[model samples]
Target: MKVLIADDHGIIRLGVSQIIKEIDPGSTIHEAEDFDETIRLLNAHIIDLLILDINIPGGNNFQMISTVKSKQPDIKVLVFSAFSEELYATRYFKAGADGYLQKDTSPVEVKSAVNTILSGKHYMSQNIREYFLQGMIRKEVNMNNPLAELSDRETEVARMLVMGISQTAIAEKLNLHTSTVGTHKYRIFEKLAVSNIAELIEKYRIYDYS
Candidate 1:
């Protein structure tokens, strides 16, 4: 089997490569330190599986899944992220991930998830499964999700804020006035009912979904 490990951290790539080797001693493993490199490698190799990080450099969004699938429709993708499953796993699944595993997962479960996806099955934790069931039962928008209240632009600004980007920097990146970015930040905090970036991040982890 051929696998691509796409993450910015050298340590994480090394560790997961070791686990993949243990899972299949003859498996061919390739590593990418960023999303651009990942796409380049994908174009250069017939990868069977891609282990992806959500926050890899050059992209930190679900569209990355679409891009990957567009490049190689048959490749199975496993989202390996440090983000909370409740906030991100279902979204990744909806965006076309074969599986979602937290970075803190044990080596045994990592192997299990990888093997399961390799066999062409979806994988999710028991808790995520239960959450899906509960969501289906409710069958409604979660009104408590404050992040959902933000507009697309506001959400973009909020994410940058949570990432520690300055308002000026965000304005420059988004091509908006600094005052407009500050206004968006103020509105985001207000909508999320948070007083500061720390609170916004905490609320984000609790309520943010795709």
Candidate 2:
């Protein structure tokens, strides 16, 4: 089995790789520190599994998931992150992840989750599964008009932009070269049909508040 691990933290990447290698010595592991590198590896390699971090240099997994599904629909993604389950599990499942797990989970549970996914089943915390059922049954999901057809990278910039985040701050936050941020900003403005940040903020206030 071949696995690709993508995370910004070298230590986490190393640890995850070690664990996987221990579980399946035949596994060949690859590392990716950012979104672009991850995409490049997936394109160039026939990976059997992907262990992904929620946040990375190019964009968050919300954006990455879509790209992955479009380009390699059969590739399985096991999202491992530090985020609370409530904040992300529902969204990750809706975005097509095969498994959702927190970084703080025990090594045994991590192994179990991976094994569960590899067996062609979904895995999430019990609490997260209950939450999803409750929310779906009660129709608690936000029904806001979906954002326009913004590219994945552009969508990441949009989310940060609407949160009143500064362009320079966002650039640094995502580890992008400053000029690249500006390019994404311009494209976001065009996609959202908004003139500037103020209009964009106003439009996204509902999502932000929710």
Candidate 3:
């Protein structure tokens, strides 16, 4: 089987590659540090599975999933990100990702996710499954956590805000205009009923939305 691991962190790629090798010793694996490299590798190889990171340079949105699929219609994509499952898993699933796994996930769960996707099935954590089921039953996202109400972009901005990243820095990192990042920050504060960064941080801590 052929697999590609796309992540900016070399350690993460190495660890994931090691796990894949342990699972299937003969599997052919490739690594890419960013989205462009990932696409180049995809075009050059017959990759069966793509383990992608959402925050990769040149691709940081839902569109990345489709972009990769457009290149290889039969390739399976597993979104590997630091964003919480509650915040981004469903969005990615709806965007054509075959699976979602957080950066902090255990090696065992990573192996399980890879195996599940390789077997031609979708993979989601039990927590995300319950959230999805509840959303289906209610016909809306679970708003018990106010953070869930933020749009994907807003959520990204909020994370950066809480991490002490400046609006200018966030704009640059996300490839958005400074004014756009400011708008997202305003919406995030309004939605979460916070007035400032401190309040936002406190609210995030209370919700444990990590």
Best by lDDT: 3
lDDT, candidate 2, 1-210, per-residue tens = 889999999999888988897789989999999988999998899877889987777757375787876777888889998755654566678788999888888888888888888888999977677867777412443333334245556766887887677889888876788899999999877766788998888766644333
Q: What is the lDDT of residue 184 in candidate 2?
A: 93
Q: What is the TM-score of each candidate against the true structure?
A: 0.80, 0.68, 0.82
Window of ten residues with lowest summed lDDT in model 3: 135-144
lDDT of 3 by residue, 4-74 (tens): 99999999999999999999999999999988899999999999999998888767767788889999999
**Between which residue pairs do clashes occur in model 1?**
none
* Runs with alpha carbons beyond 4 Å of true place in candidate 1: 136-145, 148-157, 166-187, 195-210
- Can you write out model 1's per-residue Cα lDDT over 2-104, one digit (the tens) per residue? 9999999999999999999999999999999999999999999999999999889876766789999999999999999987676567677978999999998
Quick one: ranking by lDDT, best first?
3, 1, 2
Predict model 2's lDDT versus the native.
0.78
| 1 against 2, candidate with superior TM-score | 1
| lDDT score for residue 180 of model 3 | 95
Model 2: colliding residue pairs: none
Error of 3 at 146 (Å): 0.6
TM-score of predicted structure 2: 0.68
Which stretches of model 2 miss by more than 4 angstroms? 133-210
